[model samples]
Target: MKFAALMRSAALVTAVALIPATTATMAQVDGRAGPEFAKLFAVFQRVKASYVEPVEDDVLIRGAIDGMLAALDPHSAYLDGGDLQRLETMIDGNYSGLGLSVVMEDGAVKVVSPFRGSPADNAGIKAGDFITHLDGTLIYGGSLDDAVAQMRGPSGTSIRLTIFRPGRDEPLEVEVTRGVIELEPVTHELGAGNIGVITVNEFSADVGADVFSAWQDIRKEAAGRVNGLVLDLRNNPGGSLDESVALADLFLTEGRIVSQRGRARGETILYDAETHYRGDMAEGVPVIVLINAGSASASEIVAGALQDHRRALVMGERSFGKGSVQSLLPLGPDAALKLTTARYFTPSGKSVQEGGIKPDIAVPQISDPDFALRQKYQTRESDLRGHLINEIGIKDEEMESDSIADPRFQLTADELKDQGVEDFQLHYAMETLRRTTASTVALRPAKR
Candidate 1:
């Protein structure tokens, strides 16, 4: 399963323009009081004569504007002329960079996650890595934009990163060459028992078509033997909202998938799954959705919709709460504004803002003990208050479960332990799929 990283912008303020009537009033007041203009002229003359450092007046004005804007939320930001142009190119998905997603935490830059099949991922960069130095220069207390600028360069150029990872005794050094990171929207494989596993990394521009192609490939490979489908959404930070809706519509035949409510009272839009792509073989197949802490935004949209409609059973930790929709507003030249326009809601009218989607079966991931000894796992089925939607009167069904001493999903205990498969989550998912498929098939009618 591939994980997609969601890139977020640091907070700043939106620019406000003075109205014409207010400008006229200010001009009238200034003209009536010649003393105020005289005072300004005297101060300017005094500053010009007595200033110690040579400073440009335009620089001071721009600095003041920047300072004012930075006080707003971390998402709003101000971009200089060069940065504005680069942002324009980034929005078009064409840029040369290290292809890493970063965030500001504790006044330092932190790696949230690396894009799948990108330079950073290939370089062995992992999530929760703290970047202390970029190209041998200390990046602490620096602006995120400046750090990003240092990371981005011409294609085929190499950049060195000094990172600090948890559970490591010493910091590690990785040198990655910049490249044109083409976003891969979807990837799939046939799991054990011919179970179709589709990993939607992100909802990119061509994701809808890519998902369709992936489903076709899975169907062809299964040859009518596919008993279950596992939609892996782990660490998938969402992208385009429309693509998410379209992807959800692929499996669902008819029902309210998701809904969005803007700031206004009655401003709401409901999305439904209308088109049916799956035939008899595809319908009624047991679906197991995998998610984690990094899964957010559009990923949550699909997860919440499926869970609410009882279409798929979610398995993993809670998702990242990012249920808001942002609209890109062009500010002139190469500048733009990504404003939070509305809050999204699941089909049950539950808002996921600051509250994430909880799985039907809460499985705690095992990331410790060196894989030698047996590790205990916890499954939470109680009603958790922080869940996006409330689980009402739903009883946990008795499903058969299994475990492998080894880590590989397809390998048995002895084989996996020898091969050293470290992905405990995938192993657990595979077992869950087997158990669910058996239970589903056992309940079905026996053919004559």
Candidate 2:
């Protein structure tokens, strides 16, 4: 039987396909790789018979299989049961690192997305850029975990990265200082004009309910009617799929919310509005979903659904474009396979693999004084090596959320600064709602 089939259940899909099945392979030694397997077995026997010290069969076997899977993709890896528990603990609370979401692809370490304000983000490391070397050492064929381990060190120290961005013909070098990554899953506040700003830092557990409570708090804090809402998913590396669906359902009353398609029949599933909630929580209030290159997975799921259903006006830059679903399939009681089982699509059937969800209004963040500095180092999914083909065949330039000159955005960082605007993206979205009536944002039939 196939190794993946050994899993008892495939449940709890995550942003990165983290399946914990047996790291062992079940394929028969009868294909073109048959000769290769024979060589591996022979090497194993030789090592066992004449090694410097005794090496256990399971140790050698696990190493061989791990090496095999490591070559597959960035997200695919073999985690022992202990590693699995450690991962769970990390996800549940704390960790230390340079605060980057990285993956291995095509033998190169790739940055998925640096946490907002992370050392990597501050250093201008964009998504979709290839990290070929670390500290001048070539890491093209290194393990993702090892690379991450090397990147994680005493906070406040710096590391140098040699990056190859697609748009640029030449490679660029960046130096980033490492810092601890503390994930604050959700935070909210009621801004002026009774507009509620909910910043979903990560898609961890209970986020849907948390956002719902945030909305209730926003209404209570408001002196009058809530005018608008801003779902700030910027720099949010997506988490729970169920939370994404539930969050989208907060504003969507009807229609298909999102769907997943996969090779296995079971992986193909449809999620609809009201699957988790009864009615639109913020029925008439204008919702602006803010996304950027860091927004991915569950973040894309929420943005795509609301944009497709016309339930919200997605603003800010394009998302991280991680549309694939990773299911945690249990191999035994302790281990599981976090495998990429399906590609998620918007209600309109648009795949967000390389082509992330484009906002209704493309708003660039020029508010920060260092906006230009940040633009120098940007990355996205399309720039990733071995990134799933969009099939939509989107041009690479479209994926570049880097600042392109637009005359409409004449406001310099100084201008925005003078206006007491700290966040350009959220400020612009709020100003738009203040000027435009909510009726303008109401659901309408697509032009097509």
Candidate 3:
């Protein structure tokens, strides 16, 4: 037997032994039958007995598993053996492949964003480009799973992609070599006279520790006279629930950080900053947070917490709005299930679902003159509404309970242009920090 077949057989044997034959039989005899269970069993038996082509039991079972999970929500998914391995690498923030984040759109796999400095980005793969073919094989209308499998491979292996740009009539082909992509969580630099600028790419595991260590290093370099802080969360697709909470605790003194609400079985989890994990920095020190469309999930948690507590001024376009909590459930063996168990709420108890976190200062990105037309035609949430799965059944009370009453600051359009900052959001943050700190310092009593 082939290795794949043997693995599948072993998986089935293990699954059967764990379930107990009585459980399967009892499913049929139970008083309250699950709608999904009945439908799945009926489909399985029909496919096994009536399909013209030889139907493998394993394939049918896996399909059922996928369907059941997909029905729950877009984020909740069943990771097969291979998928589980890839997920493990992703959570570690390192993977060997053409680094790209993709989503299925209009029967084509579209590049949502390419990781900075990755093979795809280096090869000029821009966000909003549709990938139609992989190595001359038409990939459109196919499963995203198959496309991801084809795109990922060993380091140094070259793969050709046929891309469809928005304005171009002809398809463009680009060949890229895969490599191991290691993401840097935090990068810092001294900006504008002793002001500390820290850009966080993502909130992964150990990100809080990394940020704290970086802050310590920056303070030592500045000799304890740091003027301001700019926390950049632009393009930071977030990670780790605990990391977000911990990071917020570093700055906040007294406020609820975030809240999670789920089914009756799972109690709400709340993180507050009043406990004081990290000592206060400069008193009334000006801090600004930068966010954009790519800032999501845990990133939103940090931004929302700081903003709600009046700790920092937030600037940028609205965030990507992925306020949901997912639990990684091990399925034994190498497989696993990433299931969405709950939705996240800001300190004020707002649900950032379809409606994302709106920035206090909105600074939209001005596209380059060459790509202006393409930018005008780009897709937004309205275009992909069909794919969104609203499973949590949230109500207005839950969403509005934590809304921000008043914003501390706002930025004008000309101010953004004058900064000449592509991430004008970050620039606004830096400038806000500078102004606030100067004001605070001016108010301090002179040394006697």
RMSD of each: 9.7, 5.8, 7.9
lDDT of 3 by residue, 91-196 (tens): 5556778988787665789887787789998998977789999999999898887898899889999999999988777989999999998767788877775778
Quote the positional error of residue 88 for candidate 3 in Å: 1.6
| lDDT of candidate 1 over 363-397, digit per residue (tens) | 55554332212121211212222222222323323
Among these predictions, the greatest TM-score belongs to 3
lDDT of 3 at 158: 96
Summarize candidate 2's per-residue lDDT along 359-424 as a digit string, tens digits: 888887888554554566666666654566777788867655565677867798888888888788
User: Per-prediction count of colliding residue pairs?
Assistant: 5, 17, 2
lDDT of each: 0.63, 0.74, 0.68
TM-score of each: 0.70, 0.76, 0.77
Candidate 1 clashing pairs, residues 3+ apart or interchain:
10-74, 11-73, 11-74, 11-75, 12-76
- Residue pairs clashing in model 3 are 348-402, 349-402
